[model samples]
Target: MADPVILVDRPAAHVARLLINRPDKRNAIDHAVRQQMAAALSALAGDPDIRALVLGGVAGVFSAGGDLPSMKGLDEAGARARMAHIHGLCRQIAEASLAIVSAVEGIGAGGAIGLALLGDEIVVGEGTRILFPFLRLGLTPDWGQLLTLPRRVGLPAARRLLIGGGPVDGAEAFRIGLADEVTADGQVMTRAIERASALAQLPRDALLRMNRRLEMPSATLSDELAREADDQARCLTGAEFNEGYEAFLARRTPDFSHL
Candidate 1:
């Protein structure tokens, strides 16, 4: 049998890394990839020991975007269903409790960039190419790009990039807030994993609430204040806060394992 398209590895106690392993197709996302990715993420979501996740692709390539060959015979209904599945996965990433970091290298094009943005941070190699190819391909952007991209780079830049812009390198991506960090080619995964591991050290429960609160683009000031007040109240009464307060008083780091 062939190797699995997605590989799950635990590089740290609280960090789970999922690598797209279909190197022959340059890690193109397809039906198989989508199903496997969803299953893996679902399993990780329930594991209290895991607090962070790293998304990457093997052989130094992020992804070539959606698998074009897989789209050859798809009818309109099929296409719609496929996009729905992808959007569901995007929602999963958006609401994930674990901190997420993307390790991007050779290329992240079209839908792949949107997928990467669902995560909290992205680390790219200096030479990595980030492209928007939706219009050029006679398609509108999918994979939640319409929502996530704007939230990531703001509406002005998102419009510019999605409508007609050409490819941008990793350094340019970092400069434009498309990427969180840019490193040398060979160190992308290492840096991404390191970032995720560090993020895992944070109080994950509070972090999840904070992410959810901030990602709500439609929430008004009044709405956010009400939500924030409730969320903060819960956090204050949680065991994590007690531990954190004790640690602060002792001038030591908080160990929140299973707290």
Candidate 2:
């Protein structure tokens, strides 16, 4: 069999670390990776010995985004199906009893940005980059990003990111509430492990209940995810998305003036 796309490491009895293993592809989330991750997360959630989970990428990169190559010939229906899979993954993370933490090193762009925000606590390296480039791709945010973004940085800041298409460094990430802590470059994973260990020592039942309660006031995650899928499906079939996707492949700026 081929190597697994997601690696699970149990450094401590109560802590489980899930590492995105496609380093050569910048850990882009593709269909296979998504499936593997879902399986791993499910198993971890069912493990009574695990109380906290850390999500990160191999090497210094978190993830680039969805695999564009895998998306080349998708239609509106195909796009919706693909996004729904990602939404399911997000739902799994949100409902898991374990305290989730994200350890970001290099960058988390597009869909990866949404994935990182799923963490209850996020630790980033000083040089880490965070970006939301949905507009540039002529697509709306998916993976429940629309809900999570505002929850992390408030409405104003989230608007700037989704509209401006610029990248934010770790310092800004922390200041703007996107990150819980920042450490020296190359030390993100270590710091994340430490944080996870601390979370593991907390009263498990109380912590799990508190996490669920915190999510109660927000719009239901499932409904928001469905809305995102609808919007993304429409955008995927539009002319603007064609131009944007083509420009990305050609490494040129997308011209959306006509659209």
Candidate 3:
């Protein structure tokens, strides 16, 4: 098989490094890329040998977010399906038993920003740029951007980034609590792996449960959890989901149904 668009490796016995490999595209995610990301994550979800995950981009770029070309062909149903898929992946990262760290070195935007926010810890390179430019394209935030961003940086900061349509550097990212550490150039991923490897040595189950508890909502916990599961189940059975999954494995853009 050809190399996966998302590369996964077990650098340490208990820690897996998952890297988005399409640097040329600035790691922009298309249907296939998103699917592969989900697949790579699912592969490690419950593996006994894996205790943590480090998610990063290539040498510098984290991701520029969703691929506009791939998105252009999507119809209403297709758009709904695409949102569902992206949401599912975000939820997975949110719920992983293994700790996840996002190592961002260059730029992250749109849904890619959502991915980074899923991490328990976010490490950015000194030169990294973070942007939320969805409104520029007349698109509402998808991929949990609506959910995670506000919580990470608070409503006012989130509004500033989303409505301002500009990039924030690593320092600002740290100031906003979006990034845990700012590392030297080319060291974000390495540092993330080291951190994850150390975390992997802890009691895995306890750590995982802690993450779950941390992610749990303070209000309507039972209601929200049930709703999340219900929506996910409905989304999984949609035609757009099927088409997107097949296109992803085939390394091509998805041809989504009308509904």
Candidate 4:
């Protein structure tokens, strides 16, 4: 039998940890992983004993983003549906009463970067890399990044990342406000759990309300989610995406000059 893609454990009385276990694929989020995460997070949200949650990935690597093979042949409608499922998972994280932390060790790229940002506090390993390569793939940002990135890193930095596809290391991530804390190599999960433990001791209702107040203003979550779907659908159906996908599979730089 195959190993479960998502692993749940209660490391402390008030803390739950959700580990993405697909290290063989760099913990890429496929349909099964998405469904499993959604179910696990939903259950955690309703557990009164769980005051905090830590999300991490196996083998020192966080997610590499969406499983490209799973997305290879998707049409516009299919792309939108897939993104919507991911959006639901993000919504679960955002709305959960439990304080959430992302223990980022390795790469958190593309949509996975968005997932990391969903955390109330992101603990990053010193060597970890965070990037958004959506433009390189000829795709728009999805998974509510359009809403969350600016709130974390401000509008100008967000534009540089989303448009220029630049990458940031843990130190740079902290300097730019993209990461809440940076720890020594291999210590991200430990630090994240420590932070979660501290957060768990706070008044739950007050914590939830404070999180809500910190949320990005001027647009509802649903509105930004809808915009993400629409924009991704448009890009997914374009010829440029085809070129980019092919180049990715061939391990070569894509030529987009003609597009």
Best by lDDT: 1
Clashes of 1: 0
Tens-place lDDT digits, model 3, residues 54-147: 8877757889988888888778999888888887887788878777888887888888888888878888888888888889999888777767
- Give the range of the ten consecutive residues with the poorest summed lDDT in model 3: 202-211
TM-score of structure candidate 3: 0.80
Q: Where does the lowest 10-residue lDDT sum fall in candidate 4?
A: 209-218
Candidate 1 TM-score over all chains jointly: 0.96
Residue 127 displacement (Å), model 2: 0.5
* Candidate 1 residue-wise lDDT, 105-125, digit = tens: 899988788889899999999
In angstroms, give how far residue 147 of model 3 lies from its true place: 1.7
Candidate 2: stretches off by over 4 Å: 218-259
Candidate 3: segments with Cα more than 4 A from true spot:
220-259
TM per prediction = 0.96, 0.81, 0.80, 0.82
Worst 10 residues of 2 by lDDT: 203-212
Which scores better on TM-score, 2 or 3? 2
- Of 3 and 4, the candidate ahead on lDDT is 4
Cα RMSD, model 3: 13.3
lDDT of 4 by residue, 72-104 (tens): 988999988987898788888888888888888
How high is the lDDT of residue 209 in model 1? Answer: 87
